[model samples]
Structure formats: structure tokens, C-alpha cells
Target: MISEFTRTAVPQLVGHELEFSKSQHEEKFHSLHEAESVIREELEELEEQAEVCRKLFEDLHSDTRQDDKDGAVINAKYLAGSAEYAAYEAIQLAAMCLKLVEMAGREDEV
Candidate 1:
């Protein structure tokens, strides 16, 4: 009786295993795709932010009055502002990447 049961159940078990594996594979693939999308979006955002910062810095630098006695002060202010913007942007990007990485790790575990 036991042998008869095994013979019937074994075939069904094999089919179930195959289906489960396929489902698992698809899930993993989808997860990886999502992670890639996140990376791509982050990269695009960073690039745009950098471009804006660069343009702003250039504009500020160019607007400095060359003949004015306060020209040095204007240039210094522009430099400081640019530096602060760049640092803030760097920190934001780092945080975004860190969160993405952590999320990916959690998904992988699941």
C-alpha cells in the first residue's frame, strides 16, 4: 500500500516542485529588475541635480563684479555656496543608494 501511494504522489510532487521553482525564478527576476530600475532612476536624478548645481555655480561665478572692490567677497560667497550645495547633494545621493541597497537585501532574503 505504501509503495502504491508513493508511486502516485511522487509524480505529483515532481510537477509541483517544477512549478514552484519556476514561480520562484520569476519572482527573483522581477526583484532584480526593480532594483535595476531604482538604480537607473537614482542615477538620472543625481545627474540632473549635478547639472543644475553646475549651472548655478557658473552663473553665480560669472555674475561677480570684476571691477568692484567687493569682487573677492562675491567670489568667495559663490565658492562657499557651491561647496555646500555639492556636499548636500552628495549626502542625499548616498542616503538614497543606502536605502535602495538595504531594500534589495531585504527582498533577497524574502
Candidate 2:
């Protein structure tokens, strides 16, 4: 089941992505190929952020001293931010896929 936060947040993030895309680009994607390229780029960024979070998680677990652990806890907040950005990227990727379908006149099929 979807949580209330997800229900509220996903649409808001997607809307933001749509607005940002419009501001950044004068034209919609020219073709599926172009849309695919953009989607791949977003996916790459999401993957990179995931890697960052993984490294942070490993560091958080590996540290021994109370001071070091305290620092790791603070760094975990950075991990949370990275995860949020990754979610945004995922939403942006979804929005782009929807746009591609609409551009192809296949929204009805979806």
C-alpha cells in the first residue's frame, strides 16, 4: 500500500520536474531516442547518488569511536538528502517517460 507521504510527494516532485524541464528546454523531446538519452542521464545520476549513500552507510557502520560515530550520524543526514534527490530523479525519469508516451500519441495505450 502507498503511504500518505508518497501519495502527496510524488505528484509534487513530478510537477516540479515538469516545470524545471520547461524552463530549461525550449522544445520537448524530438524523439524516443532523445527521451531515452535524457532518461539514461537521470538514471546515471540516481545511480551515482545511490553509490554515495552506500559508501556513507559503510562508513557509518565501520567507525568505532563515539566521536567518529557521532560524525557518522551527522553524515547520515547527508545520506538522507542524497536519497531524497535520488527520489526526485526517479520522479523526473518517470515524468520524462510519460512525456515520451504522450509525444508518441500512445498515452491511451498506457
Candidate 3:
């Protein structure tokens, strides 16, 4: 089941990604090939962030000391931050996909 936070947050993040991309790039995707390259790059970034989250989760599970509540809390917060970043990357990837769909639709109308 999807969490309420995710349902709302993902679309908002996708919109933010689109705005950021528009600001950073002078042109939108010119072709499906170009869009594929951009999507691939975003996927690589998402994979890297997911790996960071995975390592952090493993560390939190294995290294957290039962007596050191403060340290555990810190580790948990760090994990959450990394996970959030991964989610952000995912949103960017989704935005890229949406862009591809939009481009395809436009081509169809031509």
C-alpha cells in the first residue's frame, strides 16, 4: 500500500524536477534517443543513492548499540535522510519518463 505522504510528495517532487530541469537546460529533449540518455543518467544517480541507503540501513542494523540511544537516533536520522535523497532521485527519473511521454504525444499530433 502506498503511504499518503508518498502519493502527495512524489507528484510534487516531479513538478519540482521539471522546473529545475527547465531552468538548467536550454532545450528539452529533441528526440527519443536524447530522452533515453537523460533517463539513463538519472537512473544511474538513483542507483547510487539507493546503494547509499542500503549501506546505511545495514550499518544501522548491525552497528547500533543497545545502550547508546543517542547514537542510534543519529544513525536513524542519517538513514532517513539518505532514503529521502533516493526518493528524490526516483522522482526525477519519473519526471524524465513523463517528459518522454509528452514528447511522444506531441510527435503523434504532428
Estimated TM-score per prediction? 0.43, 0.77, 0.82
Report how far residue 103 has shifted in candidate 1, in Å.
0.9
TM-score of 3: 0.82
Q: Cα RMSD for candidate 3?
A: 2.2
Candidate 2: pairs in clash: none
Off by over 4 Å in 2: 64-68, 106-110
Model 2 lDDT per residue over 1-110, tens place: 99999899888878777767867873468777898998899888888888988987777766634558777877788878888888877888877776676567754556
For 26-51, candidate 3 gives per-residue lDDT tens digits of: 33688779999999999999999988
- Give a tens-digit lDDT track for model 1, residues 1-110: 56988678655554454355445543232455665665576567657766766765565565553444366566557667766665444544444444455557877799
| Sort by lDDT, top down from the best | 3, 2, 1
- Misplaced by over 4 Å in model 3 are 64-68
lDDT agreement with native, every candidate: 0.56, 0.77, 0.83
When 2 and 3 are scored with lDDT, the better candidate is 3
Task: Score candidate 1 by TM-score against the native.
Answer: 0.43
Task: Please list all clashing residue pairs in model 1, or write none if there are none.
Answer: none
